[model samples]
Target: MRWFSSPLRDCASPRDPSVSRSRVFIYLGLAVTLLLLSYQLILDRGPGIGTSWTAIQGIIVAGDEDRFVPDYVQPAEKELVLAAMQASNMSWVEEHLSDWQVNIYRADAKHDDVGLTVPVNKGNEAMVYLTYIIDRYWSLPEVSVFLHGGRYQWHVDNPLYDSVISISHLNLDFVQEAGYVNLRCAWSVGCPRELEPARYLRERPDDKGHPTAVEYPDRFMELFPRAEVPEVVGTPCCSQFALSKTKIHEQSLEHYVRLQQWLMDTELDAGISGRILEYSWHMIFGKPAQYCLDQRECYCRTYGYCNMTDSDIQNQWVWRGLQLPEGWPEQSESAE
Candidate 1:
C-alpha cells in the first residue's frame, strides 16, 4: 500500500480544527454584522430607499396657499357645455349638474331651446367645441368644461363610467392652474405615445382605421403654419376636455376660425377630421405634443382621488359588461 502525504502538512504542526472553525465563524459573523448595519442604514432612509413614499412625502402641511383649493376658482366663472345631437337625451346634465351653468350645442343644425346649434354637423364634437370658442371668444367664461352629452359613457374617467360622478368631483382649481385638462384621465385608448407623425407611413395602422391619421403630419403643418409638425401627438381621447379662458386666449381668434374653416372645407370624412382635431386639442391649448399625464398624478390632481397605487387603479377598471379593444360601442348616444 502506497500512502501519499504532503511534506508541508506533515512538517506543519497539526492545525487546530477548533481554531479553523473559529476563523470561519468570525468571517461569517463579520459578514452578518456588515449586512445588518447596511440594512439599518437603508431602514433609516424610509419605506423606499429611493422611490416616492407618499407617507413620508407630506401633503398640504404647508400654508393654505399650498393647498389644492385655490382662491382663483369662482363658481360663476365656470361654464359647462354638452355637445349633443338633435336626438340625444340631455336630461342628465340637468339632473347631475343642476348647480352648473350648463349649455348645450346641437350638431344636427336644429336649434335647441337655448338657440345654440352648430352651422353644420361636420366634425363630431370638434365642431361644437370650436364653435363655442369662436362664438364666445370675447365673453368666454373663466373655465370652460366641454363634455359629451351622455351621462354614462365608457370614456368618462370614473368607476361607474358616470359623467355626473366625474364632473361632480372635478378639481376646477386644477383646470385653472393647468390651463388645459382632458376630462378623461384614463390612458387606455390614448396615451404616452399615440401618434408618430414622422413615422406614419411605416407605423402600424390604427385599429379604428382612421384615414386622417395618415395625413396628420401634413394637416398638422397646415393647421399650424410655419410650425414644424411634432414627431409624436398624444392625449387622452374622445374630445371632452376643460380649457381655461386664458388658455383659449393664447391662440388668436382667427386661429380657431381657420381650424373651423378647415373642418368645414376639408374633403376628409367627418369622423376622420374630428379624430385629427381630437389629437390636436392638447397642442392647440399649449400642452406638449406628447401630452400623456401620469395616471396616479392625474387622478390625484384632476379629480382629487389621491394616494392610489397601480393595484388600486387596476381594481377600479372594472368594465361593466363591455368587452375590450372590440366591444367598445362605435357610437354612444352622445359620443364624440
Candidate 2:
C-alpha cells in the first residue's frame, strides 16, 4: 500500500550520518505540506447539515383570490413565504428556486371567464391542493414545500407579518438540518381517550401520535371510502411543511389519486375537512405531527412563531373551531 510518506521514509533512512539529518528535514517538510493540504478540504467545507443537494421547489397554493372585499376571501399571505425564501443566504435556494407554482384556484367570475369551474369556498382548497400535489408536483424530484397561501398561521396575537418574518428568517442551514421541517401553527392535541381510547394511528409508542387525539371514524370513512380506520387518529393541523420530493415519491400514485378523489367526494364544510385532513396527513407520510413546545425549538422554523403564545393556542380552538373536548380551556389571553 502507498502511504503519504512511504517513499520519503526510505529516502530519509540514509547510510551516512552526515546526510541522514538533512534527509530527515526534507521528509518532515514534505509530510507537513501534505498534511496541511489534506486538512484544508475539511476547513473549506463548513458545517453542513444533511440535505439532498437537489434544488428546492416552493409550491404556493393561493386559492384566496379576493382580499379587497372582506366578504369574498381573505388576501393570501404568500408574501411572507416568498420574502423568507429570498432572505435565505443559501446560494442554491436563491439561485435555483423552482419556478413558484402559484395555483390560484379561486378566480373572479365577474372580471372574466376563468377556468371552466371554480369553487370560491375554503372547502375547495383541499381539492385544488390535491390536484397540484398529484398531477403537478409528483414529477418534481427535488424538495417540495407546501405552504398555505404562502402564509403562516399564528397562535399569538402577533401580526401575521411578524410571524412570517420570523419564519422567513429560517436560513438555508436550518432547512438542510431538518428532514421535514414544519410549522406548529398551534398546540398538538391527540385523540380524546374517551373517543378512540388510543393516541396514535397505529399501536405504537407516543412517537407521532397525540395522547389526546380523538378518533374521527366517520370523517375517515368520508375521506377514504374504502380504507379502514387507522387504530389511532392524530390531529396535526395547518398543511405547512417542507419535504423532499424523494420522501413524497415513497407514497404510491394510487394513494395520491385516492386522496384527491376522497377530497372531491367529501360533503363536509371547510372547517371539518381541514380537521380530517390534519390527522390523515401524518398517516400518508407514516409519521407523527410536530407541535412546537415553548422549550424545544427544533420542530419548527428558525423563528419564534413556532413557539406559540397562550393567545395563539386559544385562537386555534376558539376562533378556528378545531375540535376540543368539553374540559379544554377557552382562550382568554389577548392575541395582540
Candidate 3:
C-alpha cells in the first residue's frame, strides 16, 4: 500500500525543491508583469495629470498673491435680481433720433455730493428723466439708484437705467432747461442688514502681494475631460483661468498680448485671451457703460474711452473688443 501511494503527496510536500522553486518563479513573473502595467499606465496618463496639477498649482500660487473677497451682497440676492432682470421683457432702442444726447450733470454740482441726471427720449417723442445720487460710503464700489423725481411718462415700464444710461446715451447733449424734468434722491450709507456680514468681510483689504485665492491649474486640467485638453502646449486654445485687475496695471495692450502668448504657449484656449482682453478693457478703460451709448468708436486711436473723462487723452481704450489679425490661431477640438 505504501508503494502504491500517489506521487501527488510527494509533489505537494514543502521538501519538494522543484515544486517550491516553480511556485516562486510563477509569483515573481506575475509581480513583474503588474509592475510593468502600472508603469505604462502612469506614463500614458502623465501629461493630463501633470497639466491639471500645474494649473491648480498656478491658481493656488496666484491666489496666494491675490485674495478675492467674496462680493458683499448675498449670492441669492444677486441671483434673484439678475434672474428678474433677465426674465423681465424690455424693448431695445433701435431707431436713430435726430437729437440723441445723454448727459450726467453732478446732482449737487454746486455741493460736493455728486448725483447724476439722465434723460432719455422714448420712441413716442416724449422724454423721461431719471435722477439718482451716488453714495460712495455705502460701498467701496458704490451702487447708484433712482431719486424721487425719476419717472417715465411715455411707457409704464421703463428699464432702470442707472447702470445702462451712462453707456447707452453718450451722444445725448445736456440741456439746462428749468422745470423740464427733475428727480432728486438723498444719499444713504451702510449695507443692507442681510448683506452686512459679507460686506464687512470683503471691505477688509487684503495685504498687498498676498494671493486671496488659489487655483491649481494641474488639478483643473486633470478634472477637465480629455477631449477638451490639447496634446501640445502651444495649440490654439488650452488654458482657462481667471485674471486679476492688478495683474494688468497700465500695460493694457501688453497685458493682452501676454495673455494671448500664454494661451498659445500653453496650448490653452485662444479665445480666452480675447475674452480676458475685452473684460480688462472694460474694467480699465470703459466709461461707466451707462454714459457711452455708441462705444464702437470709443476705442479709436484718437478717442480712448475710460470710466472718467480726461482732457489729456482724446480717446480711452477701456473695454475695447479684440481685433485679431488674419491667421489667428485655428480652433482645435482637442483643446475645447
TM-score of structure candidate 3 = 0.19
lDDT of each: 0.77, 0.44, 0.24
For residues 18-60, write the lDDT of model 3, one tens digit per residue: 8789999999999999999999998987666643523443232
Model 1: number of backbone collisions: 0
Candidate 1 RMSD to the real structure: 23.0
Q: Model 1, 24-72: lDDT tens per residue?
A: 9999999999999999998897764554433423333113232121112
Candidate 2 ranges with C-alpha deviation above 4 Å: 1-103, 107-124, 150-163, 171-179, 185-215, 221-232, 289-336
Could you give the candidate ranking by lDDT, starting with the highest?
1, 2, 3
Greater-lDDT candidate between 1 and 2: 1
Compared with the true structure, what per-residue lDDT tens digits does model 2 show for residues 156-177? 1123322344344443345344
Q: Look at candidate 1 and tell me the lDDT of residue 288.
A: 86
TM-score between candidate 2 and the true structure: 0.45
List candidate 1 stretches off by more than 4 Å.
Answer: 1-75, 111-114, 201-210, 318-336
Question: Sort by TM-score, best first: what order?
Answer: 1, 2, 3
